[model samples]
Target: MSSIKWPKKRLKRIVRCKYGDSLSKENREKGDVNVYGSNGVVGSHNKSISFGKTIIIGRKGSSGSVHFSENSCFPIDTTFFVDKTTTKADIKYLFYLLGLLELDKMNSDSAVPGLNREHAYSKEVLSPSYTEQKIIAKYLDKTCASIDTIISIKQKQLELLEALKKSIIHKAVTQGLEDSVEMKDSGVEWLGKIPRHWKAVKLKRISKIQSGLTLGKQYSGNLVKRSYLRVANVQDGYLDLQDVSTISLPKKTAAGLELKKGDVLMTEGGDLDKLGRGFLWEGQIEKCLHQNHIFAIRPIKSKLMAAFLTLITTSSYGRIYFEATGKKTTNLASTNASKIKAFPIPLPSKKEQGEIVDFLNKKTTQIEKLKKNIIKQIETLELYRKSIVHECVTGKRRITDNDLKE
Candidate 1:
């Protein structure tokens, strides 16, 4: 028989979602009990509010999301929960049904958006018999687990690919391309050793650090307006010039700040890994300037090649140096012009610098292509998993005893 012919019932008749109690960080005693928030397990506590199998529904924050706990758990005030005692429906079946409803989409229009229980209770669904509900849940449990395993394998492959790329770049920039070259101690612990012929010198010796134009300053007379680059416009190896903004500045100050071809741009700070993220400017935008948060390093033509400088600064060595020296808060790290000028550069001959840059450009391109292919496969698998859950819970796909046997 078609699922459309099944008896109709409101969700409230099958289950009741109770409000979770408030548990603050100060009061929480750590133990084995899972402490849940709007998303899922946030921490562990010494006590649990609900016992046995339970379904947690997000009330705010990640509103409409669902989480299942096999044993007792404490659901914080940001969520609501239902257990065996609160529902006549099969616990697993209700979990699948709620997922199909996409509760996150039914958000309230309050200042801090939340889910209203009244709206959720009014949602009508097909009511199958007790025995059939268990059967549907059983089928989904097996099928979804199989799909999840495949996704996990694909995700691992992506991590491996990224690690491989980082390793390749780290090796080329720190050690010269020639394997037979004599080695000398770089003195810097994180930098280890380098080619015997290279010199370890301060960046200020070979490059002029030009601070960008600071925003929000009031000019006394008619000021010239020009497009400028923000930290967002620059990535590790490339520029995103599509949405560049314009700023007003004194004509002389604007001219001095104009980005030149082969000038390397670097950000002051962000996340630990993103500190000093930068790219060399190829003069993509005409008369473009950069914001104060970004530093433009112009290499002295005879001493350093811009391409080589960009590669070393974006490599693993640069990341290590920035992270170690940058002044850090709990979530972000930053460096100032003085720190940037003092950066140590592992100097290679001008001829050798160009060779290393060319080699890395070709190798990194190949790794990126492979990564894009795997990412696409993972996206497709996730969509398929969602469709399967929706189909089974809604009875669009019926499960028979013989089907489970296979």
Candidate 2:
């Protein structure tokens, strides 16, 4: 810690934030110059907006976000560009200092969020000597880079965990736990092989695909209100249930739509990967009706278990089937009840199904626990990175050429 009293100065006196020029898709010529938006590099262009190293501040959209470019780049209309020529302070030091200001909070109240430059200019910052500024920046450049590397490693661990979970589920559902069992070709392309005793059956043969009630329908007679699950409430492998909304419907209609325990809930549309992705609903909420966009697959007690079917539907086999059968647009894909009813399910005896479900449940739980621990580690590293940058830039932690040696 240093006892030096750094001079306080208005932000405008330390650096000038120049308005970035608009470069639309139609006009941009492809080159090495990075085209910067408010957040970061968005595209490439032939011409450079600023020479050498520069700091880009988000002016609109991702308002107030800070990005550093080591090379000459074009900052688009949605950003503010600053370079060595615009600041008396070391440009690198200014980048770290501006990040600590929380300029994102100074965004104007509008339909589209935007940062007001005047509000940013009015804020005060501690001004250190130019020499100290470079030292702090150099130290931070090293420190933050180290933190980022750790974060990246943790992120890769999370990815591997997810891939492991998916792999386990796919193998368990498609190939039975008994390795010695005789195998046969499952006619379904995605579902390549299965045990000899197992039979490939359409989902509708073993379960009923129940379509939910439509919203905004004008109903006659007395209206009864009940909580309903929408597409948003049903996530890939679990129900969010945090903000269950209510809808008004006739008591008869509401009763028919009420969710039963052991129903597999799946969304009808969204991103291609999200289509047909869902988990089994265990009657978490009583008297809950679901929207038309969500399909509740009620498995026949005699033939299917919701948990077992849920595993099959969430596996790679299900993903491939849904993507192949689903109607596609540019970015969105959807499946109707007819398509869902035709979903191929590997049918084993009740005993085998229960055993598979139990095995998968234990495996997935362990994977999820590992994922949570890794996520927490990443969050901690990010927080520490932010705190250290703030302290060094504000002179709370003084760095010198000698400190760099340590």
* Every model's TM-score: 0.88, 0.93
Model 1, span 1-406: residue lDDT tens: 2587678899889889999999998899979999999989999899999968899999999999999999999999999999988998899989989987878878886777799898899999988888888888888888888888998998999999889888888888888789899999999877999999998888999999999888888886879989999988876557888899998878998999999998989998778887875688888988999999999999999999998887777779989988999999988889989888888889988888888888988988898998898889889998998898777767789777776775
Q: State the lDDT of candidate 2 residue by residue for 61-170, as single tens digits.
A: 99999999999899999999999778878888888999999999888858899999999999988888888888888899999999999999999999999999999999
Q: Roughly what TM-score does model 2 have, to 2 decimal places?
A: 0.93
User: Whole-model lDDT, candidate 2?
Assistant: 0.89
Instruction: State the C-alpha lDDT per candidate.
Output: 0.87, 0.89
Q: Pick the candidate with the highest lDDT.
A: 2
Clashes of each: 0, 0
Clashing pairs in 2: none
Candidate 2's displacement at residue 77, Å, is 3.0
Q: Which stretches of candidate 2 lie over 4 Å from their true place?
A: 1-3, 24-27
